[model samples]
Target chain A: MSRVLSSKVALGGWIISSLALAAVVVLAWASPAWAGTTTPVLRLAAEVAPHDPGAVELLATLEQPREPVSSGRVSLGGVSVSFSVRVEEFSGAPLLALGTAKTDAAGIAMLTYRPTWTGRQAFVATATNEAGTSLGSATTTFIAKSSPQSFAGTVEAVRPDGAIGQAVAGVLLSIVALIWIVLLAVVVRVNLGLGPSRAAESSGLKS
Target chain B: MSKENPSIAEDHACDLGEEVTEPGELADVRASAMRPVLETPRWWWPAVLVLGAIVVLGIVAWVVQVADGLGVAGYNDRAFWSIYEADLVAFIGVSYGGAVVSAILRITKAAWRAPLTRIAEATALVTLPVGMLFIVPHLGSPWKIWELVWPPYWNLSSPILWDFFAVSTYLLATAVFFYLPLIPDLKIAQEWLDPNRPGLRSRACRRIYKALGGNWTGSAPQRRLLHGAIGLVAIMIIPMAVSVHSVLSFAFASSSRAGYLETIFPVYFVVAALYTGVALVVLSIAACRRLWHLEAFIHSRHFVRLGFVMVAFGAVYLYLTFTEYLIDGYSGTSGNAAWVHQVLLGRYWIPFWFYFVAAGVVPIVIMAFRRTRTARGAVVASGLVVFAMWVKRLVIVIPPATEPLVRSPLSAGGVLAGNWGTYHFTWVPISITVAATAAIPLLLLVLFRFVPILPIAEMEELAGPEERAESVAVPGLSSGDGFRPAAALGGRSLAASTSPPSAMGEEGGR
Candidate 1:
């Protein structure tokens, strides 16, 4: 192939690859269920299960903005959705996440949370798929209660707690510290007399 | 005795030439510049005392603020960053004027810079720390300031983290740059002090100067090294300062806020900083001229020249201001259009108008008109610019904050909020700001007492013979001119010219 044509081909390939990567990110965020819709509505409903009053049933439904799916497993099959259970204290502090769970092929995720705090608590379900693509997102909040005998199902943690992020933050901070230390050292070193003897000091008054 | 001895005072004027042609003449100039340090002024103690009280009050207010929350200073969730953030940017921004002005003049080999360098450098030196202190107050949790440097809490992508890094680096560079030029002057000062002085203060000052001057054999190689180092630093500091303020602007611009999101803001902030910074340098020069009686060294021409520079930046900033608003306003973005309307016609209209007229129009008019371009006029213009610039920063910060996050078209249901959320004026920030203002001159006063306010070595270097011949001949008879050539001739002192002023005038007149 000619150099010019080959270079053009390489450039074209790179552009296509970047676009594909971006598409993947968008698909991962919005899940296949969004299908390029701007707003994906995630309805959250909190209820005390009839059989186990202590276990709060949290439900999240994924759909377009302003479009609510009918009751009982609407057909958002294979679309991934996550539901969060948060406990907020009465003092107005931020919501602390209790647990999270992903939706099954039935377009519904159920989180059974047993709250430790007695005050009003909120259950928020947010859809991450279709998040970065200017596609619509749906976040619904429902205040629920949890007291005694929560279900024995495993709780999936959804809170952002990352050791790598914290470590990165530390390394960034040390750069500033290094700058200060270097500055302080330079000041002290210079002020303590870094150069040769003064002309006047060597030869009295008459320069 | 010279305070009352009219002849001694008259002879001092005779020596007030722009240049020092001979060694003895240079000695006379050095003696005159050092006069303030050697003979403590009667007004010094009183000024220091008042400034000290203001500083103390500021500290007390900050303490109370820490005791109370940032809310005591009128901070709220809606207005998380307010006056203190503006103050941090303003103080740091103004220091750039000093550093850049001094560095540019030095790099360009401007002769007039000799009298102004020390003052400029000292201003930068003092203001950087004060500016840094303001960040503590700007933070909700001042105690967590250490977390900024602790690394683990840092986010490399975060603008705030980079802002911290940039400012700290700039501060270090400024300190180094300030000290480099003072090295030779320190040597001169150390040699001038009498070892036999009895008072502990004088002895201590001497000792300090001696230690500071260490082994500066004014050898050619040493001078070259010092000059080269200063040059390198001077070159480095300009870019460092630009980066510092650019990053600071990023802390705002990187935000999703409508007013801050404009791409023009970084340039706008930088230009505004330069304008205000130059005005501050002019003010400092004028103040030092009057307060230290440095009229001989820093003359009407210095103010006029510095005034021109200030006006130049003022013009650029005014253009930038217009461009910034015009672009945003013209873009027809609902959010930006609302912000522009709010700034021009809404609650913030007062500060905006004041800044527009006072800092924008007034300085250009003053400097442009020859009649009002004297030292006094320039000082007034500079004073207005300084105050107006502060208000401008307020205008920059507050409008965006007060504008409802949810903006609509100006024609829509209230483009601007009927009543904006308040970042009210409280005693805490007021006291702290006043204290910071007071601290600059106070620190300067203390700094000059230790180091000669003039760069003596640089002065000697610039004092070429041709310029000296003119001042020696003219020997103007103004009351402000403390020396008279006629008196010098009558006394026949070795420091004075041998010929009469009339004779020298006739010789030079041809």
Candidate 2:
């Protein structure tokens, strides 16, 4: 013990250990960044004869794939563009959305309204280009006729080792773990014995 | 006719090469320096040949796996990655342990590191390539190995691609680390090689020496440059190793699977590697001792000290295992908790316990006690520590993967779910993995047979003529009477023996 305390040799273990500890703490405490969202606008323009000022075009916009948006005709660009649209709700909750329709080279964006009883419906419009994507619309109150529906899921006979095999995989997992133990033993032994090259040199000089 | 006292051995070491400025009264620094050239041991050559055959067999096995299909070895969608990956990790992680121990010791100036540095560095060099070869079989398409350099697959986002880069970088770094220190040693080996050995080998040696040595005729400037180079490699290596293990751990962690994905996985892997790497080194050193008759060079003290390192890491690993389980289990996620239960108490309990007992507990206990702190104890402890670490690795990989991605097929009542399935290991992969395992030591033997075992210049400087004829002061290892037999730790209680080497390494001068 006296030999080392009295010796003038420099000890650097503390420096490295500290650095590693600090770096680990810094990384661990940090959190992952959240993603951003872009709201895209949909331009809704339709070809309609100018003779009918009150004439509304029946149109619908689906903001999401596999599901259509619900709402009736709303006033857009001085025309009623949306008609009676059934707002279908699946088990998964999807909120009601709205969109605005403006005029373009294509036509004046509009929603045509249709009434089942005598009530209000909602309309939505969506657009996409290089700039980004946007959704806008107005809500029309409405009542609808009752309807019926059904649900479905897949079914199959249970297989122990999966459809292919199970009895064999369990045995193999044990065997592999055993093998890992042996290989790792050899590797660990080898590295620990290899000492510091530079220190060995200096010690050689002192001896 | 006179026998030297234990104090002499204690106070002095066989200097490799240096002008010993001062030696204690009993110092005999030149005892082994001018002794004789070390002959290739008998068992080494035999092992090399035997290992060579195994390697050939492994190659054949790989071919079969390729020709017949990956089905020959154990892999299916359920266990898409199994033994191949675990083996890869166990093998590659060990290489980092070498880098950490050797480079860290060198930078820290540990005196005991002198004899084992070359061996450690060489092990790192040999196993890294074998680790890389593991990727070939991991591939669904072996021919697509080259895709690592192409687009898409080469996308930095992929961990496999990261493995390619990290492994390559580490390989290059370790090789340079090993080769740079060998310049002077190679020069000495060249001088000893007779004409019968051939001039091409000699010329090649001389040229490499010149290029690397670059006028390193033992001058102060050259020595400074060499020291600087060593320092740079040491610093560069720790992070290089961190990168290697972190990327490797990512392969498991990035998977959406619960047990496979953990925030602590990378650090856990690094610790496991450290534990296993030390054990491997201990085994090699013991083999070297038995075969080379260098017990005097590498004795019980060295083994005991390294055992301490293994034990330390083992303890840390156990804690991490607990932390992982507690956090995972307490969360009460059925999939995660069930996986833990399976590992700790299910069918896998045997291997897991074995790992805990042999690799984790026994070594630490043995290393913790002074009476059992002998060289033999160290050897046994190290062997177990390494074996257990591997078990830990395998456990790390399989359980979570086997739990069925969503629900167990057996428990689904009457319906199969998801893309669920399991894989089993076949004959081909086993043969390949074993052969690869055997091939490492075999190839290392061949490499070492050609390279000098010690740094001749350093040894020469440490044991120069000026030292034997005068008295000098060394660093911390030597006290007032260094190795005087009377000053030996005679009859010291077991308590003294079991203490960590750091205490003595830092305070031995007394």
Candidate 3:
């Protein structure tokens, strides 16, 4: 009876240790796949090349890693990549959309940007698949030496010389001035009584 | 005339309870009108003291704000324009009542306007300055206010510059409108001063009255000149008031904000001003009637008629408000739609609903029924209208100012937005606003202490035989003898009472 019990206990311990080892092996094998599936970090790089006097060729490269089992394709293409620029260095400053382009067979997207401002410009590139799932994004900064034209600051006031505005203001101010003059005149006339009082005339006649 | 004979004066005093046989008599009109100026009521001192303390508190709050900065007043970058701006609009907006009652009614020669014009005009005269003073607190640095008017610092194209011009011009016009009809009344009051009184107060009153009255003897030429001047001013003031409020709306309308950039804003503001203006006039009339015991002159009919006018404007305002919301809401623009949604259903829902219920529904319900359209009812409605209008102004100002305009980069398809900022109410602004509100009655109370509450000359002038007969012939309404009560032509009275001579002459001379 003692020999039988010891054999049973040894069998049970062997089974438990084998099952735990197998589970560890499975989890170790699946962990990388799970991480890759959950967070698919794409390699995206944005490059700026000076084109015309005030224009630049914005190039975004969406690099995809090769699979161990190859699908026998030479290039990845047709992914929609968007380009944006932030001229201001402030974190709160908004990123203005430059434009969007599809990747070529070389896995590169290109856009011609005519910058209206010359400053420390930061460029951002984002890639998304056909299903609109974001693949990844990248940012690069460069000094824009020249602007297409004189950069008008964001703050704009109503110009006094705009034709319609000028005309309207003129008319309104004239009317205002006319009203003021008339009001003042009326007040002055009331103060002076305009003419002799009828009571004074009656008193004079009585005298 | 009563001063010539003590016995006759005593007889008039005794006949106070009985209806006077000659209501159109100048002496009787003068006596009734000048009662407030002559006598200081028991309640006056306490009311003044309380109101004055509040005004002092407001001034102290303002001083603290100036010392500490606008942050103490719950102002932030997101809520740059908030309570003080609304107060400015509301205070100025209520002043339009004076224009409506004094200018518009005078132009139309509305006979009932005679008794109410003084209160209306005086209200305008005081409240406009109070409203204009709001700009001081609003600017945060009032010392630089001169830059708004100074030519070198003037931004001609700025709506703020135009606002200052329009408001100052309107204030001038309001002053002229208030003073033009007061000449003959000044003369009447001057005549009432006792020659035997030996005091600086009496002498000062005489001199001031004489200076303001000029050489007016109620003669034909003086009346003609005065009438002509008043008519011109009345006509000019209407458009001036319209421009003032329109320009005021332009300050908001010109902004490229979701809720503010509406074409309907000018007309909307003008109508709101008229609506609130009439409501205030009704309230002032009710207060004067109750306090000074001028029920014989300002009957319940005045309240009802003014209530009707207020409701008419209220109806139009409601329509305009509906139209404003419907158009902006239907357009479905991201910003405007979001703002509208926020106002109707989001964070600002309480104030919006409060305004809708108090201003939009209750007043209409009150005015719709005859039983609820009494002096007390008008007072209730007017009070609600005034408070609700202030709330409406806040709704107009704050929501748009604090709306989130920037789009988040992480948003899918540019749909998701940032959080909307909030304007928290602080004690500083509340104190200042309450003070300004209290200042209205306080200033008016002080004003009436010098000038008659009623326009004595205008009332007597409008009290011709035909007018008096028409007034007297009205069913369920009667007054002291031949005196045509301001509301005689309007409708039936809810509460009417007359002041006897003894009450009128409680303290005849200062």
Candidate 4:
């Protein structure tokens, strides 16, 4: 049998790619988000719209669009008044649910996109492996705001500090999605068997 | 079976003498007439399908997790991290072993690695992702895992961010290490495969053969280059595993949490990972041996060698465990001591002790002694090691988390100062983890279906000059350490190989 496979250039490619991937990883650690401290120093605070002192705006910085950030960290002696937000069509798909899982489990979920499906975005929650499936899921509809001119351009709260703030939510949402997409792409690339050999693989099959 | 002669005493002394032969001869000697053992064991595929269904269930759970708020699971103010985080870390940590085996073998220049490196490397590649996926399951908004990329302060100081870096680096590195060596293997596969074989899978082998191996003919230039690349990556991998495990340990250490703050954590995690990783290699080797019918090539002696490595790491891990408790325990530091106490004597006592005995001591005994150091013993030891390491992760994560980071006196009740909450596993996290576990062998089987199981070039290299001769009729496995006298008695000249003997003793040896 003749020796038939050459290793020079391919080996070089493997070396280069492994190095490049590692470099990217080292770069990834340079930044951090949470302060690693447990002080919980008021992440988010907002002013109440409609101006009622009792009608509080979302209190926490990390607020879900439809869920209350915190149900008034104040003692409401007797009243069990709840808070909520409107769900509307955004990118064609109507809202499906209007609630948040526990804060530590899921900070928030969903985006309101306009879709051809006509049902008024009901929180169609089905039973999971758990009971009390109906304890959550409330239908939230948005108030229809007609366009000022014949041509309807999407306009609501534009200012960062307006009656409603869009910056943080949009920014945070985008960041999460961005990580997902990018990481997913990277994961796909790795799984699909791209680029050089490094130290260890999950399985040690010497080829 | 002779009790007088004591086969048990000879179990630990498996030695390969100077049976070094030409690559071609070894290939001809061991080559199977049939095809690759790419198909999963008959039961494995259906099990994977069941696993797939469970994974779908996890997806559905994720949908609920997304639909409802994050609170639907056991997340609360106190129990911010629950089973999901532990499962993620534990699974990822386990992958550390797979990577280390390949790196150690490559670094030590262990010729036996020819048959195992790609599998180990692929395991690391797959499990790291699965471990990383735990990050998704752990996250309230897995989408925010990207925030790791652009932290506001870009605090290079944080461990979690470092974890992100370390794991990704290791995974990428392992992938390349695994693929590069296979280039020649692919070429060999491309050449020998019958034309009648169906295309898709075999086609990738042929393509990979041409594209990567690039006219490799086992020429001196090609051999030197391949060996050179493997050597470099071997050295590179140990550091990568260190970095990965260190950062992982740092994730726990960076916090002031009592259980996680020990300086010993990084080293401890690294050793534990190696220990478990070696065990996995042994198990996998045994499995491949049986499933693929490679008994002639991979003898029980190989398991013994792997068992020896497992024991070495297991001993070190035990030492670290003691040090972890001793330094912290003797100091009487309330937080550290309390956490240790809880782990050793509290609710989690059983798991902690279980891991200690199983992962730590039992394997050493079996490995050290001849009576139980056979292939069967090694398999048991390996399975124990895997289970023990998993339990050890639990022991490591939960206790410290249960202790209070900040001391707040009990509120006029016996409820204690820190309400360091305990975590419970939910179906969602459990299913996800199971799905990942099942996917491992399945994906590997699929991969081997398309790729060669052993590094063809490396095997030829290991077999050396006699490989081309194709007439060196030596059955090395039968020549146990005391085979010299036997061969002389049998009137057959036997040259036992010496490579496996020397390398088997090193914890650092692959």
Residues B1-510 of candidate 4: C-alpha lDDT, one tens digit per residue: 112223422432323222222232322311421135334357656755776776677777776665543445545434566566666766676676777787776665554455566656767776777778777767666666776658453334455666776677667667767766776555556556555657686566556656765444443444445556666666766877886787787778878877778788888888887887778777776665555544434545567777888899888888888888888878766676777777888788899999988988899999888888788889899999888788788777766665655454544332235445545555655666677776666666666666766554454445543431221233432333332221111111112222222111111112
Highest-scoring model, DockQ:
3
lDDT-best of 1 and 2? 1
Best by lDDT: 3
Quality class of the docking in candidate 3, CAPRI style: incorrect
Docking class of 4: incorrect
- lDDT for each residue of candidate 1 in B331-397, tens digit (9 for 90 to 100): 8776788788878888789999999999999989988887787777788998999999999998888
- Kindly report which residue stretches of model 4 are placed more than 4 angstroms away from their true locations once superposed: A1-207, B1-34, B37-48, B69-73, B151-154, B405-420, B466-510
Clashes of each: 26, 82, 1, 81
Interface RMSD of each: 10.4, 20.1, 10.0, 16.4
The residue pairs in collision within model 3 are B23-B483
Name the lDDT value of residue B337 in candidate 2.
71
Best by TM-score: 3
Candidate 2: tens digits of C-alpha lDDT, residues B53-75: 88888889888766645545755
The TM-scores, one per candidate, come to: 0.65, 0.61, 0.71, 0.62
- Ranking, DockQ, top scorer first: 3, 1, 4, 2
DockQ for all candidate structures vs. native: 0.09, 0.01, 0.10, 0.01
Worst 10 residues of 2 chain B by lDDT: B486-495
**Which ranges in model 3 have alpha carbons more than 4 Å from their true place?**
A1-160, A194-199, A202-207, B1-27, B198-200, B409-413, B466-510
Report the C-alpha lDDT of model 1 over A1-207, residue by residue, as the tens digit: 699999999999999999999998888666645444234556677777667755667777665444343453334544544555442212233345555455566567777765442223456665554332322234445323232333479755334437996687578567556656755665555443343334443334323
